[model samples]
Target: MKETTGFREKVVIITGASSGIGKAVSLQLASEGACVSLAARNAERLQEIAQECNQLGGSAIAIPTDIADQQQCRNLITKTVEKFGRIDMLVNNAGFTVVDKFEDLQTLELFQRVMNVNFNGAVQCTYFALPHLKNTHGRIVNISSLGGIVPFPGNASYAASKAAMTGFSDSLRLELQDDQVSVTMIYPGAVVTKFQEHRLDKDGQVRGSDGGSLYTEDMMTADECAEIIIEAAKQRKREVVMKPGKISRWIKLISPSLLDKIIIERVKKIIEREAQESK
Candidate 1:
C-alpha cells in the first residue's frame, strides 16, 4: 500500500452520526482536525456530537437527515458543502435491521425498509456527493458488514441489503479508478453499541432502543472499531474485513455447508433468547 494523506482539515460527511461506529469515527476525525458534517435522524444527539467535535478541535455541523429519503440525502450533502466549501470523504455508515427469521417478518416492506437505508440511502448520498468528491479526489468509506459476504441467520434481510452494498462499492471502485476517488469497504464483526438494542419488531417499529447489548459475551468497543476504520480510510485501503470476519469469508467460500451448521446453532440460541425476552 502507498502512503496516503491524512485527514487534517478535510471535509467529511458521516451518516448515522448519533451513535455507534459513526459517532466514534466522528470524534476520532475531530481530534485530528477534520471538518465533520454529522447526519442522522436524531437531531438532538447529532447537535451534541457536532458540539463535541468542535470542542475536540475540528469544525463540525449537525445535519439532521433520514438517509432513506432521497431529498434528505441530497440535503445532507448540500448542507455539508455549504458549510465546508468541499467534501473529501463520505462515510456511508447508516443502517439498521430487524432480528427475526426471514419468514417471520410481518410485511415484505420490512425488507424494503432495511434496503432503503442500508443500500439505496448510501447510493443516494453518493450520487449527490460524488461531484464534490471528484473535485477533491476524495474517498468513500462504505461501512459494510461481515454479513454482506457471509450468510447470517435470522437476519437475511440485513444480509441481503449489505450484499447489495458490497456489489455496488466494488463496481463503483472500478468505475472511479481513473477519477482518484478511492472506495474503501469495511466488513465489521460484532461491536458493542446501542445498535444491538434497537431490533425492529414485527410491526416494523424499533424495539429495545433504550436497552443493553443483545449479545451476552464481551465484544469490541465502537472506539476500537472506529480506530481500525479511520486508519483504513487514511491509508485508502481497497477493503477491510478484519480478523474473524476475514476467516468467516474464507470458510464461506470453501465450506458453505459447514458454515450453515454453525449459523443454525447460533440462530437457535438467538431464538431461545428472543423467547425468553418475550416472556
Candidate 2:
C-alpha cells in the first residue's frame, strides 16, 4: 500500500535530529511538507540537516538542545511554537544504550545517566509538547525498542528505560483519548543506526565500537524504520512493532521461557563472545 502523505503544513518536533532514525524522520517528514523542528546537542550537524530539508523545499529549523535538561526541552517546544506557531507531531528519537549484564557492570552513576537521557529526556520533552500537541490534536511518537517488550540481560538499563517509555505511552494514550492527543509507541527491532557504535562501555564511559553480532549495517536502514514510524504516527496507531523474527513477538505473548532459552543460547553466546573479544 502506498503510504499517506498527510504531514503538509504540520509543525513537527524531532529529538536526536542530528543523525540516525531521528535524522531520517526529520528528512522524511520535511519532504512530505511538514515544518520540522530538529533538536540535538550538535549545532553543526543540525544545520546540515536543516539545509537538506530546505533544499527539499520544506521548512525546518535547528534547535540545539540537550533533552536531559527539563528547561531545554521546554525551551525547544517554546521556540518551536514561536517559529511555527503550533506543534502537530513530536518524535522522541533521542537515546543511547549501555550494554553489560546488570551484576557484571552495573554502576549507579551510569544507570542514572542512561535513565536521564533515555527516559527522563523523553518525559521532559513530552511534558512540554503535550499542551501544544493537544491544541492541534497532534501525535506523539516515542521510539522504543524490542528490548522494551522483552528483557535482555546485558541491556538491562536500556531495556528498562525503553520499557518505561512503553508504559508511559500506554497510560498517556488513555488519558489523552479525550484530548485528541494520540500517543504512539514504536518498538523497532534492529535498525541500522549509529546507536550501537555509541554505546556506554563497562567502565561507565562512552566509546565507539565496530559492528557486532546484532546491530548490523545489513539490518533494516534507519530510513526504513523512520518510514514505518511516520506511517504509524499518521494513522495514530497505538503500538507498533517492526521487523524482527517472529520469535521476538511470540516471546511477548506466549512462552517467554522457551524464548528465553533460545535467546540465551544463541544471542547471549554472541554477546558473550563479543564482550570477551572486546576485552
Candidate 2 error regions (>4 Å):
1-5, 212-214, 272-279
Q: CA lDDT of 254 in candidate 2?
A: 86
- Residue 168 deviation, candidate 2, in Å? 0.7
TM-score of each: 0.94, 0.92
Best by lDDT: 1
Give each model's whole-structure lDDT. Answer: 0.89, 0.86
TM-score attained by model 2: 0.92
Candidate 1 regions with alpha-carbon error over 4 angstroms? 209-213, 273-279
* Tens digit per residue, CA lDDT, model 2, 1-279: 112349989999999999899999999988988899999999999999999998886899999999999999999999999999999999999998887767776457777778899999999999999988989888899999988877677888898999999888899989998888888889988888778777877786655656434454568898998999998998888878876644677775788788788778877677687797778
CA lDDT of 63 in candidate 1? 95
Q: Compute the lDDT of residue 113 as modeled in candidate 1.
A: 89
Show how many residue pairs clash in every candidate, following the order shown. 0, 0
